[model samples]
Target: MTYWQMRLALLRHPISAALAAVNQSGLFVVAIMGTALPAVFFLILLNFGILLDATQPSPSRLPILLHLILLQLLLIGLMRDAILGSKARLLLISVPGHQADHKVSMLLATLVNPLLWPPLFILLSTSPTNWPLMGAQWLLPVLLLGIQWSGLFAPAPSLVYLSLIFLLSLLPLSQPMATWLLSEQGMITLLLMLLLCQKLPIRTLFNRLQRLLSHLPLPVSSYIAQSVIRQELHGLVLRLTLALMIVAAGHLVQTQVAQFSGEVQTLTVSLLAVIAASWQLPLNRFLSAKREFLLSLPQSKICRATLLGQPLLLGLLLFQFWLHHGEHCWLQIGLLIMQISLIQIVTIRAERQFVLASLISTCAAMVLFVTLAN
Candidate 1:
């Protein structure tokens, strides 16, 4: 098969495609949230020092803003590589795809997607004079992505690149540099880096991984476990890390001053992550697919019982986080209960209408959340 055909086939892989479709709905939820001033303000408060806080003398939005930008960049980067990718697909590409010439498609996959550019545009629209930093912004991540893509054969790339972003998170930049990194320039630089990383004999390594994934029972178990962890576990880690990093950055800026107490904001952010992650259950996919044997009425009742049990289980766990962090834990706990149930029920009911179900469920939950806020 030709290379383009191979790449398309890989993108069509079930796990990657299904998750991408779900995330698309999640992104829709985000855009809707952006329209609410209170939601946006509250989110900024979670990460950023309020620009007008009268009590703190040494306050600036720069650190928090920069951290926010970097966190989003890291998230979208991983989504491009991981949620939208499968090792099996990459393996197929590496075999029949192209050894050295796959750079163009790789670049396209990274930079030329639907939801990325508008955010990049908004970020860049801030300042036209800070163009060089823009280039650096894209370059830094792409370079890291390249290093990451190259090392994906072994375990080194992900750790190394994550470490690199973590270290970069600790660095302080001037306003202009920060502005540049916040724009399309940053996105391009990161994409090009991934393209460069494809210079390796990825096909050969992919063939090896594919073989390993298929042959031994141990390998099979590992892949299955990896799939579950990637789908369920680290999904929370991704958002939680963003919250923690922002809190950490805010703390660093405030250490020189004694007046700042950002604990409430930090706590709010942590809870925010917990709530967001709870909504990522695979209920829609579960109900939509008939790949498994059909449940009898009794069996369906048991399964529904288990599904209803999810919100309770999630609430208890989230309560532990909320109990330590902030007030209104009960309110959020109640909100989570409603949100999960609505999401799960809507997803199941709208089984084949995955997108419509998520959109309706999310909007309904958001309305309830806003009502509670008022």
Candidate 2:
């Protein structure tokens, strides 16, 4: 009873919640098949390694690998919430030696995390012969466990973890001097730093920043936009990651696969745009619920537009960077606009409806993409 409850509590942690959101979004099957965005991202990294040296592995990839590990830590921090619910907290804390039990439960949750398994499985399968790289890759999960365990006792905001991860990621940029930073000794040192982070005045620093932001005389829309972005951050990051992976895959196909037609490439990109636009459904609902209050504010039209355009702007920037090399730049941008506009028409009301709408919208977008590409 205690074990399962503890496991459930750990499973509800922010890291798991984001993944759950993905699963609810109808990508659970893709995740199970190990073809998910995280897996593709890792494979892309390996492809980069291959580009560096088709004959022999390169050590330069180590720094980037560290960066990915740091990313995982940052994700945990971003999605983090209270580790235990009120009832679970009361029940679990009453168990004798509950700390040990909680650690064990956390370990189980970390292993079973769907978002993590794909990348870790890819690393193990591909690098069995390369023990050094394999060992280095395995450190990601360990670091995840360590950071999450720390969160169980002392939860810090994502910004604090991001700052620490950023500082650590920069340590490997100098190559020769920084190689030792990823070594076994270096990993132990990093773990110590992770533990020591609990000692920082994280709550105080976070509060000060929030208070400063609140005091600023910002428009109602800008303020709401910030709040909505923070609230939807987990899902937003997941969707953007999916979009980027699709874009990267399309880039790889275009560059490497000559037999694949332009129509197919465009279809892939259109699907990417649709994935990017999926976040807007939730964004619309979030705003719609507050419609009455927002209308009460002055310049509400401008605020509403600004709030709504935030997601689209992010999608535009991503596509712009991806499509800058193309000849028909304006045409491609138009196609992207059509793709986003098309998906926004399909609203999400329930799980089944969302799945149905997503499939129908994606197919429609693909047809649109293929037609435009020709």
* Highest TM-score model number: 2
User: Which 10 consecutive positions of candidate 1 have the poorest summed lDDT?
Assistant: 50-59
Question: What is candidate 1's lDDT per residue for 1-374, written digit by digit as tens?
Answer: 77656556655564365456435645334333336757544554433333212133322433443344344444444444443345555565466546643464455445533223433444455477765544533343344344433433323333433445555555555656655444466546545534443454556776898898677665232333344445554454444444444454334444544343333333333334334434445533433452253253335655545544643565455344334333455555665565555555554555345445545554555565556655
Which is the leading candidate under lDDT?
A: 2
Tens digits of per-residue lDDT for model 2 on 51-168?
A: 3232432344443444444445544444444334333556667766576765564655465444466555556567457756455445655766676666555556434655676555
Candidate 2 colliding pairs:
none
Candidate 1 CA-lDDT value: 0.45
Number of colliding residue pairs in model 1: 9
**Candidate 1: segments with Cα more than 4 A from true spot:** 1-20, 23-97, 101-333, 345-374
- Please give the TM-score that candidate 1 achieves against the real structure: 0.40
How far off is residue 249 in model 2, in Å?
Answer: 6.2
